[model samples]
Target: MSRLRSLSPATDEVLGEYEIAGPEAVLAAVARARAAASWWADQPRKGHLLRWKREIAGRSDELAELIAAETGKPRGDALLEIMLAVEHLDWAARHAAKILGRRRVGSGMLAADQGAALEYRPLGVVGVIGPWNYPVYTPLGSVSYALAAGNAVVFKPSEFTPGVGQWLADAWSAAVPSQPVLQVVLGAGETGAALATSGVDKVAFTGSAATARKVMAACARTLTPIVVEGGGKDAMIVAADADLDAAARAAVFGGFGNAGQTCAGVERVYCVRGVYDDFLARVTALTKEVTRDAYGPMTIPTQAEVVRSHIKDALSAGGRAVVGGAESIQEPFVSPVVLAEVPADSRAVTEETFGPVLVVNPVGDLDEAVRLANATSYGLAASIFSADQAAARAVARRLRTGAVSINGVLGFAGIPALPFGGVGDSGFGRIHGADGLREFSRAQSVTWRRFAAPIDLMRLDRNPSALERARKLFRLRHAR
Candidate 1:
């Protein structure tokens, strides 16, 4: 039997070997989920799914340990991810019915005799492909919302973090043990592709832009709608009037947290020329002080090579590291590195390094800051640090990203009700709040004739007189 291996990134220990679900197994899993979807969907108010969310909250530590072992993140970081995932799950379960419920709408004059209603229906089954960096929180962002919205889910977690996926599925089954509301197929890209084309109602993929393209193309073959969350080349813009201390802290935490493997982590910092020196000093000091002992190993082995390549390219392009040099990157781990004067065209600036690296560049003005920030192909999430609320709002409004944190980094992602996703290369479709609920459901507009009208436009009885009156009324009301 073919198996997927899970290794501990921190100690290079073998965590466990998991069965690899092939195309046939994936199709069978989806078929089981399809059969169970209707049963699960028919339950009112998600059949105590809210309680299941509470279960996750209660036992999050156990799950977090599992996450830590598989992904090699610290226990603290793993718990944080689980905590947020539970919060989102609870929010989704509580709000899905209200968000997708039937709502009355006003009938326009043309349909004055008819009663109009709008409602959303479940999309049956959803296939989710999640990344390894944020295995618990990121995947649950889609899985929880989909389950709450009344769709059964078939989740394909990153091969590096398959244990987290198993925990999620096992937890859900324990909560609602009646059926297979959510199923997981474990393997690499082939397994994911199989799930994508296995006739699921929709696919929500979270990973690299290149991989997203493949997933998007595969789903297209089946005419299946997909939500692509293709990671981010997220940036932080420090305006002239920004809070230097707060911005510095945010930059350090955002850039170094989770070994800078965050999809929304601050990869680039564009500072206005006025306080550029001061801001750079603060960030560099803080980044240097921040220790990597708490940071676990990089989940993906090849990712270290990518980070090294980007750093080498920046150095080759005349960029300088203020805090850490090329020596900072080692196999399975990276130390926080503060880069200064990196070329905008450098790979570290243009692409996602996904390591404990930050490239800070001085901008002549806020306009230049915004322009440089928007120059990236990715716009998943960004941060704006400014003391002036109005100015911050203005600057944040112009960033070409999905979510922006005005005063802090990753503040928007912690908000359970806000939508999370990106545009352009970062990918589209949202996965939280009302938008998230509707994303898993299909809209249905219904119109019915409540009663007889004085003159029925569709009826053949004396419709000419009514038409003449309607024309007269239009002419009188609308004509110049």
Candidate 2:
């Protein structure tokens, strides 16, 4: 570790910080996790899951504090994250038996006498590289599910918030007391790269799309299976007859909450022309009411320039700033920025502005809204505010994304039953619900003989005429 550097919420000045992990440290931790995986996988699912849940329940407050301190998110939000993690853990534990249990499968007619079955098995040791935005919830989407699927985890938290990862590992160690099934390898890019290249069974990564590409390439070198959960340029569309007040509230909460550091946060808004003005007014008012505290600074300092560039592009492209202008950025904390009349060509319209900025565009109708919403390279989660369930489902099916919310923003992520992930440049594989649980494990097919083998069709002693007669009889009976 290197010397600590202090960081400011504004002005990009340093306040306080610590060094990230190195390659050696990451490798050592991963090695330990690999050694412990067998013991964890050998444990009964019922007992291991109970222990995991008890650990989370016992350390709820501590986990929230650690998450808040490391991510600079509000305590309430941190608590919400922990709650979601616990919920997923509970769901995964209870449902793992059914979701991964072995069941019979019908073989083709050629192998009718033989019975086949498929099952899900643990993937030994799994590596997770988590983002700093939602330290507890996001990683646990993989961590809890992986544990339930019987894999030991070697988690590498983002360099921006390594402390959070360390805290989680510490708590697990304290709770289990049997073996350190969960471990943390804290560091920077080198540490993450080390984990990706290590001999882990699989890697579950969540971060920027560019970084996801690099991670994928590194894993490719070792032919290791991976699940890439890159960031999203999520959008929320307001229908012509939509409730402006409700849509505005959701847009503000979804876009600017947690300093707009959410992967599924609202980056773009396509409002129906009939209620565009009303929606914008309400959203602007909501944006103004949000206040930034000293605790929640920009967790990723380098993102400051990225935010600035998006704002500049929107302004230059003839977009009017409804709330935060370029000057509104106050360093570690940024006031909410709302842009209207933004050109479709602007970066704010096409790219993932992972900040407190929103671009609101008007469409003639729901069809136009759908077209504009699906224009981006990244397609993660999306919101369609409409009272008509049939219309919402129709629009959702045509949107070409993973999860779609009918009357809410990012509701699919909150629903433990729904699979949460993205498509296209946003990356593939889900991180929540049943899909998430299986991502950390491999499907194992098994067959056990219940009866003696039938004829000796493969034996050299079998006559060619006998096989020919059987084949002709089978073909004659099956012919249409």
Candidate 3:
């Protein structure tokens, strides 16, 4: 078997080695999950899922340490990510039954003599392809919800964070020792592709749009359904009547938090002319105070060059680096880079840099700000700051994204009830909340006759008069 090694991006220290699961191993894991899915789905999953959640919560510190070491994120940030994951797990476990349980539906007038009902049934097995940036929180968005909806899961964590995925699977096994309801398959892109075509009922992928396309293609071979949480070039909009201090703080944190590795993190900002200078100054001062120790290194080494290229491109295009420049990228670690007056068309503004960089641009008014913010092909999420709550909500409605924050940034992600995903190039399908639970399940509808109809329209020999009556009734009821 081929072996894969996990390393600390911060120090290049070897963390642990895992045996890569090729196509056969991935198929074996999926088969076990398939066998387990039948038994697991029949049981009351709420208790089992809650117990698993508790187990994860109990060892959160240990898991956070593993996540930090593998992904090169600060321990505190890792803990925060775990905390949010636990909250979401709790919500999914507690609410899955109510959201997916069978419910009676009213029969329409045409079928008045029939009774109707609807329910969501789990897909037998789910294959999850997770990302390296958010080793824990992001993947759990799918894993927890899939398990709660009563589906067995075979998870393939990112090559850089396979340890975290194994840890989660081990916790689930310990929580429910009787069955292999959740399992981990370790490897890189090949392993993920194997799982995608491994006959799983559905695949939930979290990664770049380019990779998402490959996964989609692989799954298409088996006609397997998929939900993709592709990364985003999210933006933050500052209105003239916004709170400069709060807006600036939010922009800085949203842009640079998690070393700016977040899919929904703010990467672009459009400030109305009224408060552009003040907002820019506040952001610059706050960004300067952000020391190198505030966040960890870029988890992926190649990402440094991408960040550098964006900064260099923006600078060459008449953008000014008010905080740090391309020089800030020292191998694994990238210091905060705040660019002002960056052209709206620059790669730094239009694409997902996925680094500790922010591009702030001044707009003529709120309309221009909205236009610029929505101009991007990637519509994942956006943040709007305004004193007028109604106007802020109106702006939120106008934006073409999956989620929005009125005065804050990335606030929609924390609320478990709100479905999270992107639109356009950012990818499709939702995870989190009611939508998340249903994403892993297929709806089953059933109907039966409660009584015999007065006129049997189906009887061909004597249906002429009945059909004429039916047409007259339809015209009376539906025609104007």
**Highest-scoring model, lDDT:** 3
Winner of 2 and 3 under lDDT: 3
Each candidate structure's TM-score, on Cα atoms with residue i matched to residue i, is 0.98, 0.93, 0.99
Query: What's the lDDT of the predicted structure labeled candidate 2?
Result: 0.82
- Candidate 2: stretches off by over 4 Å: 1-21, 448-479
> After superposition on all CA atoms, what RMSD does each candidate show versus the true structure?
1.3, 2.6, 0.9
**Candidates in descending lDDT order:** 3, 1, 2
Residue 303's lDDT within candidate 1 is: 85
Q: Candidate 1 — which residues are off by over 4 angstroms?
A: 459-462
Error (Å) of candidate 1 at residue 443 is 0.6
Candidate 3 TM-score, true structure as reference: 0.99
Model 3 segments beyond 4 Å from truth? Answer: none
lDDT of 1: 0.89
How do the residues 1-480 of candidate 3 rate in per-residue lDDT, one tens digit apiece? Answer: 799999999898999999999999999999999999999999999899989999999999999999999988889999999999999999999999999999999997778888999999999999999999888899999999999999999999999998999999999989999999999999998999999999999999999999999999999998999999888999899999999999999998988888999999899999998889999999999999997678889999899999999999999999999999999999899999999999888999888999999999999988998898899889999999999999999999999999999999889878899999999889899999999999999999999989997766756586788888888899999996
Clashing pairs in 3: none
Q: Which ten residues in a row have the lowest lDDT in candidate 3?
A: 454-463
